[model samples]
Target: MAYTIDRHPGPDAPRLGAMVLHPIAESVPRARRWFQKFIAPYNPACSVDDCALMISELVTNAIVYGRSDDPWVVRVEWFREGASLRVEVHNPGFPASVRVRRPDANDAHGRGLLLVDSIADSWHSGPSPFGGTVVSFVMADAWPS
Candidate 1:
């Protein structure tokens, strides 16, 4: 399935921060920290710990599944839409490759997207305008009144 890459936050949504990370295992922690710090100023109502965990999982997936020899980079962007927070992880991968897997108890892998589904208020995966896959999630009412 071909997805329009223009799916992004609108004018009303303010961008918080964006980072282009190397497609490496080490980038996961960095992405989490960056997300945590950027959203800290907003005092989101959502749990920062849960957000961080989701970011970590997404970044790890990008590094593992989205890796390619040509463009070895992953982009992570965050935006604030009123009380909601939106995050996107972009990589040179296929949208079909991203799915919520049903992992067994013994499996060490295949649990990333499941965590995202359970923790995030909403999430989606599609092609990025920049020529790759983009997996995004939204935490509604993230900001406090």
Candidate 2:
């Protein structure tokens, strides 16, 4: 699938970046790499490793649970909000259906959201104005103050 990356900045505006990806298992790694590269300039302040891990889980959840009959694409967007970085994943799923699950120690799956909740400074899932569900998380002090 063809992917589009947008990096537009203004003098007094926040730095913004976005990408569109095919909703497939392969896209999870792609999303993680994209997020790491996009936030590289911000460096150690952002916790690139943690951010990448969270993005991986979020994208995986979108691919596995957000699937629908329609040709819906996964949209990932990030922007600097003051000293924090906010990342959002948009998919064609109901926001109410997105929840954190407590899997048993023997389970091999279903720990994605738990990782996200633990790592993100703040996170939320809600209906998107763009016509789908949006799962977003923020990393505090991601940018120099």
Candidate 3:
């Protein structure tokens, strides 16, 4: 079994795997729309939807926390690693050690990663060798939610 990982993908980079990059902003729903369009042609059923939400949460954090007008980058990269699908989002955020903390019970936010951590079969956030932090999640579908 071999695992293939591609960087900067398109028709020129090969089509076996799909990738999409968008400029991130404060509007999470808008960002998610790009994810939806990017995955729509390739993914059927609800897998893409779930993947979009995962992307939304990551991009939302990037836009809200990055606080930079240097044209933030939002990339959704995925490929099959054995039987599981791995998804990663890259942005120009400082690759510092970050911990998603739970706020007060009534807080309206700060729960996005919780949802992601809960839903993803295996998930983590770490520094990308290229730049910034990358939030990567792997879904096996067989893993208990």
Q: Count the backbone clashes (under 3 Å) in each candidate.
A: 1, 0, 0
lDDT of 2 at 92: 87
Each model's lDDT comes to: 0.84, 0.82, 0.62
lDDT by residue for model 2 over 1-145, one digit each (tens)? 5254655565453546677889888888888887777677656386888988988888888888785777888888887877888888988888898999999999999999999999999999999766779999998887677
lDDT of 1: 0.84
Poorly placed runs, candidate 1 (over 4 Å): 1-10
Model 2: weakest 10-residue lDDT segment is 2-11
**Model 3 stretches with alpha carbons more than 4 Å out:** 1-27, 40-46, 67-70, 142-145
* Tens-place lDDT digits, model 1, residues 1-145: 1112224456797677788888878788888887787678777788989989998999999988885669578888888887898889999998889999998999989999999999899999999887779999999988863
Q: Give the TM-score of candidate 2.
A: 0.89
Which candidate leads the pack in lDDT?
1
Say which prediction, candidate 1 or candidate 3, comes out ahead on TM-score.
Answer: 1
Query: Considering only N, C-alpha and C atoms within 3 Å, which residue pairs clash in candidate 2?
Result: none
Per-prediction TM-score to the true structure, in the order listed: 0.88, 0.89, 0.69
